[model samples]
Target chain A: MPSLLHHPLDPASRIARLMLAEYGVPVDLEEIKPWLREAEFLEVNPAATVPVLIEGDVIVAIGPLASIHAIEDSYSPEAVAGLFPTDAAERAEMWRLFEWVAVKFNDEVTRYFIEEKIAKRDQRGSTPDTGVLRAAKANLHEHILYFNWLAATRRWLGGDTMSLADFALAAHISTLDYLGDIDWGTAADMRDWYSRIKSRPAFRTLLNDRVIALPPQKGYADLDF
Target chain B: MPSLLHHPLDPASRIARLMLAEYGVPVDLEEIKPWLREAEFLEVNPAATVPVLIEGDVIVAIGPLASIHAIEDSYSPEAVAGLFPTDAAERAEMWRLFEWVAVKFNDEVTRYFIEEKIAKRDQRGSTPDTGVLRAAKANLHEHILYFNWLAATRRWLGGDTMSLADFALAAHISTLDYLGDIDWGTAADMRDWYSRIKSRPAFRTLLNDRVIALPPQKGYADLDF
Candidate 1:
C-alpha cells in the first residue's frame, strides 16, 4: 500500500486522495501540518508540502504526479475509462479544466481563504482578516459562475466523460464547503455538479475527514446534499 | 500549422514558445496584452490569459496544455524522444520538475517580478515597488540555489535526458535574465546548465525576443557568457 502525507483541509491533498481512491489504489493517510516544516517530512518532500505520496521506493512530491495524471499513468484506461480520455483532444480539455481549478481557482480563492482562516490561526493565532475573506469570497463567486456555465453546457467538467477535471474541481470546492464558504444556492447547476461528484464512493473518506478545530458545514457529508 | 497567443516576456508564453520550437513545430506567434481582456481572446480563453495555443479546432487555454504537454501530445516520442520520456518513472520526474518551475517558481518569483516591472508599466505607468522587487529577488536566489543543486546532481533538470523540465526552468530564468535581475555568478552550476540550454537552436527565438520598452541585458543573447 502507498502512504500519503497530507492535511485534512488541503485542497491539493484532497485531490491526491480522491485520485488514488478513484483509481482503486489503497493508501494510508498520514496527516501533517506542512507549515511546521518537520525535518523528517522535508526528507520525503524537499518542497515541504503535503500530498507527498510514497509508494514503496517511489516518492511523488509534486501535483502532476500525486494527482490524477499519476494514477492515469499507472492504470490502464480500460480499468478507469472516465478518469482520463483516450482521445488527445479530450485529454487536452481535461488538462485545461484540471489546471483551471488547480492553478487559477487555488490561487485566486482557496489560498486567500486559507491564509485568512487557517494559516493565521496556526502560525500566529491571529484573527481572520475580514478584508482578505471578503476578497476571497468575491473571487469564489466568479469561479462558481464559471463552474455553473460549464455544468450547464457539458455532462461533466471536462466533457461528456467524467474525468480528472471534475476531481480537481471537487477537491477544491469540497475544502471550501468544509469551511461553509460556498453558497450552493448561488448556482443550481454548480450544486448539481458537486452533488454528483460528492456522492462518489471515492469521496467518502474526504467527507469523513474531521478538522477538530474547524467543524465541517452541516451538509458536507450528507449524500443528499 | 498552429498559432500561439502570447506576450514576449511572459514566462508561461515563453515556455510554450520554446516547447513548440523544440518539437520542430511551426507556429505563428501573436503578442497580446492579457490584462486588456480583449473580447475575442476571452472567447477562446475565458481566463483572458496569454500563451493560448490554437491548433485546428482545439484551443488550449491553460499553461499545462499550451506548454510542453501540448507539444508532446501532438508529436510522437519516436520523432522527439528527449522532450518527454517514454518510461513512466522518468516521465513522472519530468512532470515533477516541470511543475516545480511552472507553478512554484512562477508564483514565488516570476509573477511578483513581472507585476513590479512589467504589469504596472502597462496598467498605470506606475514605478516599480522596491519592497516587492526586493522580496522577489530574495525568493529568486533561493530558487536559484535549488536549481544549482539540481544541475549539479542530474545531467539535466529531470534526469539524463533533456526534457520539458529544462525548458520550463529556462523559460522563467530567461525572462528574469532579460530584466538583468539574475546574478549569473551566484550559481555557477545553474549558469552552466542555462548556457547549454540557451545555445540550443530552439532557444533562438526567445533570445531574439526584445520587449520594445524594456531592453535586454547586455549579455542577454550571448551564448558564451
Candidate 2:
C-alpha cells in the first residue's frame, strides 16, 4: 500500500482518495495540516499543497493530475474501469473537463472557501468579507450552469463515460456542499450528474468526511439527493 | 496552420508561443484581450483566460497543458528536439515543472503584476495596492530561491535535458525580468540556465516583446545577460 499525505477538507486530496478507492489501491492516509507550515510537508511539496503520494522511493506531489497519473500507472485498465478513457480523443476530453474543475472551478470556489474557513481562522482575522463570498457564490452559479450544459449534452462532463473528470469535479462540489455553499436547485442536469457521482462506492469516504463543526448540508449524504 | 487566441503579455500565451516556435509549428496568432469581456472569448473559456488554441474544430483552452498537448499532437519530433521528453517518467517530470511555472508561479507573481498594471488601470476605483505589490515582490524571492536549488541540483528543472519545463518557467521569469523583479545575483546557476534558454531561437519573439511604459529591463534583449 502506498502512503498519502492529505487534508480531509481539501477537495484535491478528496479527489486523490476517490481515485485510490476507485482503483482499489489501498493507501495509508496521513492528515496534514497545511496551514501549520510543517517542515516535513514542505520538503515533500514546497508548494505546500495536498494530495502528496509516496509510493516506495518515489514521491509524487501535486493535485488531481498527479493522483490520476499515479492511479493510471499503478492499476490495470480493468481495475479502475471508467476512471480514465483509453481512447486518445476521449482522454483529451477527460483532461479538458478535469482541467475545467481543477483550475477554473477550484479558482472560483474552493480557494475562497479555504481562505475564509481555514486560513482566516489560523490568522485570527475577521470573518471573510460577504463581498468576496457573494462574488464566489455568483461565479459558482455560472460554473453550475456550464456544468448543466455539459451534462445535458454529454452523458458525463467528458463524454458518455464517467471518467476521472467527473470525480475531480464532484470532489470540489462536494466540499462546497459540506459548507452549504452549493445551490443544487440551479441546474437539474448538474444535480442529476452530482447524484450519480455522489452515490458511487468511491465517494463513500468523501461523503463520510467530517470537517469539525462544518457539518454537511442536510442531503449531503443522501444518495437520492 | 493552427490558430492561437492569445494576448502577448500573458505568460502562458508567451510560453505557448515559445513552444510553437521551438517545435516549428506554424500558428496564426490572434490577440485576445480577456479583460474586454467578449462573448465569443467567454464561450471558448468562461473564466476569460488567454492562451486558448483552436486546432481545426477542436478548441484547446487553458495554459501549458493545453499548449503542450496541442504541440505533442500536431508537431514533428525533430523540430523541437528534447523540448517534450517522450519517456513517461521524464515527461511526468516535465509536466511537474510546467505546472509549477504555468499555474503556481503565474498565480503568485504574474497575476499580481496584471492586477497592479492593467487591472487597476481598467478599474480605476481599485487603485494598485502597494501592499499586494510588495507581497508579490517578496514572494518572488522565495520562488527564485527554490529555482536556484533546482538549478544547483539538475541541469534543467526537469532533469539533464532541456524540456517544456524550461520554456514554461523561463517564459514567466522573462516577463518578470522585463519588469525588473528578478534578482539574478542571488542565483548564478539559475541565471546561467535562463541565459541559455533566453538565447534560444524560440525566445527571439519574447526578447522583442514591448509592454508600453513598462519597458524591459536594461539587459532584457541582450543574449549575453
Candidate 3:
C-alpha cells in the first residue's frame, strides 16, 4: 500500500490526494506539519515539504510536483487517461496549465492566502494581517478572472478533456473556498466549473477534510454549491 | 524550427536552452527580460516568464518546465532518450531531482541571488545587497554539499544514466558560477560532476553567452578550473 505524508489544507497535498482518488488508488494518509520539521518526517523528505508518497521499497516521491508525477507515471494511461492527454500538443498544454497553477498561482495566491492568512492564524495563533490578506484577495480576483476565461472558453482547465491542470486549480481554489476567501457570486464560470469538479467522488476526501479549531465555510462541503 | 524566449542568466531559461541543445533541437534564442513585461511577450506568456517555446502554428510551450516537456513530447524518445528515463521508477527519480532544482533550489538559492545580486543591479541600477547575497551564498553552500553527496553516490544526479536532473542542476550551477557565487574549492565532488556535464557540446552555447554590460567571472568559461 502506498502512504502519503501530507497536510490537510495544502494545495499540493490536495493535488496528490485528488490524483490518487481519481486513479482509484487507495493510500493511507498521514498529516504532518512540515514546518515543524520532525526528525522522522525529515527522513522522508529532506526539504521538509508535504505530499511525500512512499510506494514499495526504494520508491519514494518527494515534494508536490514529484508526488503527482509519480502517481501519473505508475498508473496505466488506460486506467486514468483523463489526467494526462494523449496528443502531443494537448500534453504540452496540460503541462503548461499544471505549472501555471503549481508555480504562478502558488506564488501569487497560495503563499499569501494559505501561508500567511490561514496557516499563521491556525498554527501560530496569530492574527491574520489584513494587508497581506488584501493583496492575496486582489490577486485571487485576477486569477479567478483568468480561470473564468479558461473555464468559459474550454471544457476543462487544460483542454476539452480533464487533466492534472483541473485538479491543480481546484486544489488551490478549494482551500480558498474553505476559508471563505472566494466570492462565488462574482465567479459564475468558475463556480460552474468548481461545482462540476467538486461533486466528483474523488473530491469526497477533500470535502470531508476539517480542521478542528478552524471549520470550513458554509458551502465548502455542499455539492450543489 | 523552434524559437525560445530566454534570458542568459535566468536558470529556468538556461534549463530550457540546455534541454533543447542536448536533444539536438535547435531554437532561435531571443533574450527577453521578463520583468519588463512587454505586451508582446505577455501575449506569448501572460505570466511574463522567459523560456517560452513557439514551435510551428498553435504549439506554444510556456515557462521552463513546459518548454522542456514540450521538446520531450514532440521528439522521438530514441532521439533524446537521455532526457527522460524509460523505466517508471527511474523516471520518477528523474522528475524528483528535476523539481528539486527547478522549484527548491531555484527558490532557496537562485531567486535570492538573481533577484538581489543580478536582476536588481541590471534593471534598477541598484547596488547588490550583501546581506541577501550572503544568505543566498550560504544556501548555495548547503545545496552544493547535498549535490556533492549525490554525485559521490550515483553515476549521475538521477542515476547511472544522465537525465534532465543533471541538466536542470547544471543550469543553475552554471549561472551561479558565472556570478562567481560558488566556492568550487569546497565542492570537489560536485565540481567533478559539473565539469563532465560542462564539457558537453550543448553546454558550449551556455558558456559562450556574453552579456556585454555584465561580463562573467574569470573562470566562467574555463572547464579546467
Interface RMSD of each: 2.9, 3.4, 1.6
Residues B1-225 of candidate 2: C-alpha lDDT, one tens digit per residue? 788888777787887889888877778888887888789887777667777777787775454455556566667475446576766677667766777777788778888987786656667487878999899988888888989899989998989888878988898888778777788888898998998898888889888988666678898889887
Sort order, DockQ high to low? 3, 1, 2
Backbone clashes in model 2, listed as residue pairs:
none
**Model 1 misplacement above 4 A:** A60-67, A80-82, B56-67, B77-80
Question: How should the candidates be ordered by lDDT, best one leading?
Answer: 3, 1, 2
Which CAPRI tier for candidate 2? acceptable
lDDT for each residue of candidate 1 in B114-204, tens digit (9 for 90 to 100): 8888878876658999998999999999999999999999889988888878988998999999999999998999999999999999999
lDDT of 2 at B54: 78
Q: State each model's CA lDDT, in order.
A: 0.82, 0.78, 0.85
Give per-residue lDDT, candidate 2, residue B158. Answer: 86
Steric clash pairs (candidate 3):
none
What is candidate 3's lDDT per residue for B123-187, written digit by digit as tens?
65578888988888888888888999999998899889998899999999999888888898988
Q: Which lDDT value does model 1 have at B71? A: 71
Best by lDDT: 3
TM-score of chain A of each: 0.93, 0.92, 0.94
In candidate 2 chain B, where is summed lDDT lowest over 10 consecutive residues?
Answer: B60-69
Give the per-residue lDDT of model 3 (tens digit) for A1-225. Answer: 898989899999999999999888898988887777789978777878778888765546888877887888775357446587887778778888888899888888887877775567646557878898898889988989999998999999877898888999999999988999989999899899999999899999999999878899999999887
